[model samples]
Target: MQLLKDQERSQRAIKALIITPISLFIMISGFLLLKDNHFSQVATTLFAIVWGTVSVVSFFYSLNLIVQVFPLKYYNKIIPFVFVGPAILILGWYLFIPTLRSLYLSFLNRNSTAFVGLENYKYVFTDRTMLISFRNTILWLLFGTLFSVFFGLLAALLAERSSIEKIGKTFVFLPMAISMVGAGVIWKFMYAYKPAGANQTGLFNALMVAFGKDPQNWIGTAPMNNFFLIAIFVWLQTGFALVVLSAALKGVPNEIEEAARIDGASEFAVLMRIIIPSIAGSILTVATTILLAALKTFDIVFSMTNGLYGTEVLASQQYKQMFKFLNYGRGSAIAIIILLAVSPVIYYNLKEFNKREVF
Candidate 1:
């Protein structure tokens, strides 16, 4: 019986191994054929939809068959790979491989042909524009994140108590719908500058003139201009933090707050000792999310100031090095630096999520 069972398992394994390759080959060949043959736009779309659905189903079915070929003892362990293996492979191919390539390219010269070693990294730290970018980015990370979370938590608390909670929250949250570039363009007009004697067109300038002040160049003003950009980030991100923190606040037990109040705790004391501590995890999550966004801030700066007048962030600097200057080495080095800067935050965020069983 044991000998017969072994023969049967061997036969099944051989059939699975053979069939999996043949199915994959046919799947690839059919996709190539479909791609190569020109069809009308609607017809091509239809074919692609059908082919995609069929291909996914067939591929997963083949994977399951391969997994089933394993012995019973290993079946549970191997089965998970049938579902997760494709995602792992895709991430490895697209994300991991490119990261390694960027690291390698960071060591090369401008043309990516000759070895330059740490010269690119040296320039990244020592270059005038790069230093300014680092400063501005740090400001963005600090102020942008601080104001966003602070205002968001404040709004969430206020909205929870307001009679017209939905209406107030809706108005505050509406900015979250605007794209960063769209917000930048809208604010650009608000900060638009003209000669002092001329009529002010920009909203801020017009307001300044209304208040008997000169229409100053808002975007052109160094150091402070970065804060103005940070304001846009705060505007866009605050709504997100509000929604998340509001939900988290709701999760805090009312009994705890009531108990604290019964014990003669003030509103502020209750907030500090009870509510905030209870929702600390959510606040940290929101802060980290905003921090990552601030770290990678590019669209607004690019759209409004184009990294001019000390408004440069790491992302905009990387863009300039890659496209404007066509310096691959410096670009890759800056890219790696940005990656390294964000990696710790990402790891911390993931660790927190793991502790919370979020995944």
Candidate 2:
């Protein structure tokens, strides 16, 4: 009897092992069938059927494990997802299929017919507008992030001892809570300008007029308009910078500051030598986050200047190409180009943080 039971248990184990590997192999092979364009339709359908089978098999396998941990009473909860099976169907319809389609579309032509074979990618590198947008993207990565970090650091330093520090921080962080579209609209009003003669509603133009300078069409200007648009991003980002760096600043021990002070260091010298070094990791983290944000920024340039007048960044250019021109290949190329540019910086920053363990 014992030998018979042992053989049965071993058989069950082998069966589980066979099912798991076979299920996974089918799942993977379903996707590999897409190598030929001629097979794309069949391969796409195969993916859905094979993936669904894998999911059903894997779920039962995983369900037994989950049952051991979660109480039996909660088993009712799992039954609902089983009933509404279509939430998953909706995800494939809205998210997964569309994403796969876009990636596939990247290989096709401007009209999405007769494969262009990376001509769009070549334009991403060689076209004047795309190149200009790339340069502007770099400027945003550098100056936009730097300004946000600098101002946030300054605010954190200046507000550390204030009675109204909460108020000051709240004001600074208010922009962060606002949606990007809202911030863009707000900055539009701030940068609002009329022709030199009419009364200006724009805060910037009002200030210019206050200084007796004529209110110019700020958005219509060359290269400098890009800077003006970038400023809006910095303004919105600085508060977040301040909050994170301020927490980091507080971590710098008072003993170190006191020792620097006792050694006859000026306040600025103490901040430079003690505070700055103490918070360098946090500062780098904030700067990298800001760099990512600036790289991805679309609404500010879109709302303020619409990628016109050399204010184009990759994100805005991608939107204009995909949505406005309906050029899927060019749009996907722009996206891939921006991803290629920023991915390294982001990867490096992630590696540096892991090396430092700053978080």
User: Which candidate leads in lDDT?
Assistant: 1
lDDT of 1 by residue, 142-225 (tens): 999999999999999999999999998998999999999999999999999999989889999999999999899999999899
lDDT of each: 0.92, 0.82
Model 1 TM-score (2 dp): 0.89
| True-structure RMSD for candidate 1 | 3.1
| Clash number by candidate, in order | 0, 0
Runs off by more than 4 Å, candidate 1: 1-50
C-alpha positional error of residue 270 in candidate 2 after TM-score superposition, expressed in Å: 1.6
RMSD of each: 3.1, 10.3
For candidate 1, give the lDDT of residue 310. Answer: 84
**Tens digits of per-residue lDDT for model 2, 23-61:** 666656655654444456777777677677776677566
